[model samples]
Target chain A: MYKIAVDVMSGEKKAEELIKGALKALAEEKELELTLIGEYDIISQELAKTDFDSNRLKIEKADQIITMDESPVKALRKKKNSTVNVGAKLLRKKEVEAFISPGNTGSVMAAGLLKVGRVKGVLRPPIAIQFPAINGSTLILDNGANTNCSPENLEQFALMGQLYAEKVMKIDNPRIALLNIGEEKTKGNKLTKASYELLNNNPKIKNFIGNVEGRDIFSEKVDIIVTDGFVGNIVLKTTEGAASFFLELIKDSFKTNLLSKLAAFILKPYLKKSLDKIDYRQYGGAPLLGVKGLVVISHGSSDSTAIYNAIKAAKKSIEENMVELIKSEFAKNEELE
Target chain B: MYKIAVDVMSGEKKAEELIKGALKALAEEKELELTLIGEYDIISQELAKTDFDSNRLKIEKADQIITMDESPVKALRKKKNSTVNVGAKLLRKKEVEAFISPGNTGSVMAAGLLKVGRVKGVLRPPIAIQFPAINGSTLILDNGANTNCSPENLEQFALMGQLYAEKVMKIDNPRIALLNIGEEKTKGNKLTKASYELLNNNPKIKNFIGNVEGRDIFSEKVDIIVTDGFVGNIVLKTTEGAASFFLELIKDSFKTNLLSKLAAFILKPYLKKSLDKIDYRQYGGAPLLGVKGLVVISHGSSDSTAIYNAIKAAKKSIEENMVELIKSEFAKNEELE
Candidate 1:
């Protein structure tokens, strides 16, 4: 059985909804056990409303909660019983196989780095998120973690991202591409050029596609795209903005008139399914890879579905022993270097 | 009168179609002169079919043309008679007020920088583009040029972008914002934090509205969004992908059945209008700002409409004397510093 520690006092406005979703997911999936970290009274009250088995749900009391506006370092240092601190502590002690949170991103990242620590030889741990593409999803790493990164950090990101694609996403021999301005070897800034050279020289990479431009990101030409946090965050947010804008445009198109509204009803199911396929929330949260312990960080605006998926994602990481796999991979690469 | 040099050999296909569009635009607007730069024989042949005035439409012969596959810098040095080189040279010599091309971006930027040079105090020139937002279009700088930037570079980008909006876009007292991970001053990486401090203290910027996150990009929170080239490019491309994806979804929704097809017709005009509002091609091309001479770069696959708008944009920049304005602005700021 996979045991996961979930921060119940996370997200902006949907704390109760998340707990309810976690209970529902637990009820449906029998092989999962959840340790809900939050205020005892509030969580217990919400838990009472749900019809989940008492054995599947375990409560861990936390007196403090970190606000989104608070400094992550300060909050993590001061608030000993905060949800993020408690969840991370559990993962460190091996009490839970994995820890998941949809709270303050800075706090989660801080706690993960401070409490769980980094994998040996890994310069910096990066968060990898799945982006929907034509074939399936592409693994985009360092989506806002380690903003300023070296070429070596990007090379490490490629290795970890490739492993995640193969082991977790079940893609065999995933093609990795260095995100760049053009496909040419001589293209892009010094960092991208250096990273490209490293990736090309590294024989461990299955298929090293020279360079993938921004336009070809959604074309599914490669399975793994490795870049620094600054570029990665822009790509992530831009995708989110674009998705939201397009969804709004479609909704506006459907509401134009009665006839279009009727057409919308006929095609609503297929459209929803298509949107769902591309939705990042369906994939739960981005996993903070290269860390000693398993940690998954979701969006602050995450709903119940996102929380449930994050729980499932954490369980999958635990079951697959991703942390150990990553450590071993890094150890081997370091020795070779 | 606005005299603009138009490169006929810039796009992927249909040079004649683009010329025809430019002629049409010139016919509708009386105070414009177009110097159509291309192969003299081919341009004359195409012009023989149209009734455009020979005086307003001057054909210039260029022996060499830059191919899409060729290296931009290498081609610029070798192919001196290329359309891009010739047009940019004309602008540099004060023969034409501004030079516009719907062809190779790298060649245009390379030729523009090498031939025209940059405004004093400008470390790197940024290519700025306007995005169709809720209130109006917001100016985003360094769309794809100058990937790695320092805080000083971003500060210059903001000042230039602000001038573009106020002078050309005609927005008085434009609000400038630093694009970041969060709205707080201490939210972003070292580069952003330093830029935030610089922008906050600068008196040249009419309104420094603090930091705006990715979600607020389309909103009317600010007029100019300043970011590094890496992030800017990702945002630009992701928006393009999402727009294309959403439009495809709408088309699929319309093809669900015969009834849906009918509904599509009913809502077609309104949908088209909304799509047109967000159509980036309507804005012509992104200008390589901070260059000594006016240089505008369009996409390789730009259609006739895009070429025409590029010419129009070039004309406006010429009339506004953007290069001189940038020089004066930098000079004044240098004195203050």
Candidate 2:
């Protein structure tokens, strides 16, 4: 069984929802082992409420909880036994194959970098999230791990994102592209322009398809999109906001009158299914790439379904042995430059 | 009558849709006079095809056309008689109150800076676009005018954005907020963090809220959002992409089966009305803020409706004397700083 350490004490709901979600994942996936790192009393109470496989589920016992409001790096440094840090410890000890957190993004990133550590030859670890597009989900990396980055960092992200898409996403020969304001190699800010040259010339990114604009992102124009954390974070947030805004408009329009309400009732199933496809919850969370150990960061407001999906994603990553592949890729990187 | 110079040769359709849209606007608003700048033959022929007030619409002969693919500044400098340059010349000479362009963005920005000249105390002029939020439309400034910006530039954007939102958008005492990764005062990249401090401490921006996240932008969180042009542009494009993607999903779901198709037919009118509100064309183009004169920049793909709305937006800006207000605000900048 693949061992996974989950920071149940992270997120807004504390251990209550996360524990239940982990229990649900255990029930669904029998070949999984979960080390729920949180307050033992809370975990036991929650575990007692749900019937989970005692053989696969266990507790790591973390007392300290990292609040979202605290400074991420500072909190992680001070609260060594915080659920995120504890989970990282388990992963570092080789007791768990993957570590998952739904707490403050900065804290999770700090834990991944400071506690879990970076992969060999990795400049900066990036968060690669699946963006739901017209054809299928397109992966975007450097999704808020580092606000500022070098062109080399972006080039590295391109290679990492492509590999993740190929291995975890299971896309055959993923097309990699740089995110920019315009499609031209000469287009965009200094960072993108410089990164464009590196990404264009680099043999590591085989299917580099030049620069792509924001509109093309959701059109299945490319399989892997590489950008700095700054742009990537904005894109992710904007997508969520816009989707929520549009969905709200559709909901309001249908509920405005009795006739439209009845029509909405008839189309409810179709609309729900369609909306669910774009929901970030369905895709779980983004994985922090270029980390030594597998790390999945779920959305702060992830419910049971999101948590369950996140666990499944962890299992997939472990099965693929993505960390080992990443190590192998970086081992030969010294000769490329 | 307020005289306006319309770049009739500005988009892909040449003078066909632009002339018709200009004619329609002239017919609707009798107090407007349009100096259509393009090839004399094309303008007169397209003009003759429609019934318009001869007194309201006139043509300025221009032999050059700047293709979208051409280098913006290079084309603008070489093609002196291009529609954008000719219109800028008219505005500079006080022959027209406003210059509207749907051509290359960089070329228009260059023309506005070099040809028309900047407002005396303005550091950098930004492009402000209306983002349709749940409560109402929120104004976002610095939408791709300048990629690299200082904190002072964002401060100026806040005041200019507030003025535009107040006068043109008719929102009194608009709440101006700095766009950042998080709502906290210190949570962002160097540019955003520095800009946040400036925006928070400045007195010119009366109703200043602290930093707001990307998700809060489309909600009724604030009246005006200010950021560097690069982030602003990405947010604008991402919002457009996500909305289009979600709307397409909704449309596809309704047509997936015969039962849902019937339901869609029943709810067609409501859906169309709801979608139109989020449509950027309905609100018109963004104003190139901090310019010496009124400059409305529309999307490259702006059709008849978009052109008509842009004309309306230009007229509104002129009536509000937004340029004069921006000049006055910057005059007192030293004392405020």
Best by lDDT: 2
**Kept native contacts, fraction for each prediction:** 0.37, 0.69
Per-model DockQ against the true two-chain complex: 0.49, 0.73
Give the CA lDDT, 0 to 100, for residue B259 in model 2: 94
Name model 1 segments beyond 4 Å from true. Answer: A257-259, A334-337, B256-262, B333-337
- How do the residues B1-337 of candidate 1 rate in per-residue lDDT, one tens digit apiece? 7778888876786779778768977887688888889888888889898797677878878867888888989999999899998898888887877788877788888988999888887889999999877768889998878878999899899999988988888899999999987788887788899999999988877788998877667777789999988778777877776667666655775676786677667767767776676887788889999988888888777777888788777777777888889999998877977
Q: Chain A structural similarity (TM-score) per candidate?
A: 0.96, 0.97
Clashing pairs in 1: none
Kindly list the per-residue Cα lDDT of model 1 for residues A1-337, writing each as its tens digit: 7888888786775569889768877977799988999989999998887577788779999978899989999999999989999999998998888888989998999998999999999999999999877668888888889888899999889999988888888898999998887789987878898999999998887689888876667776888899888778877877777677656766776787787677667767666765676777888899999998899998888888888888877777777889999999999977987
lDDT of 1 at B185: 89
State model 1's lDDT.
Answer: 0.84
Q: Per-residue lDDT for B1-337 in model 2, tens only?
A: 8888888787766579877778788999989999888889988888777688898888998888778888989999899889888888888888998988888888888888888889878899998899999988989988888888999899888888888888889998898888877778877888888888788787667999888878888898899998888788888888888888888888888988999999999999998888787988888787888777887887887778888888888998888898888888888775565
Q: Which stretch of 10 consecutive residues in model 1 chain B shows the poorest summed lDDT?
A: B241-250
Candidate 2 residue-wise lDDT, A1-337, digit = tens:
9999888888887678787788888998989999988889988988887677899988989999888898998998899888888988888778999988888888888888888899889999999999998988989988888889999999989888888888888999999998887787887888988999999898878999998888777887889999888888888888878888888888888987999999999999998898787888878788998888998998888877788889998899899998988888888896565
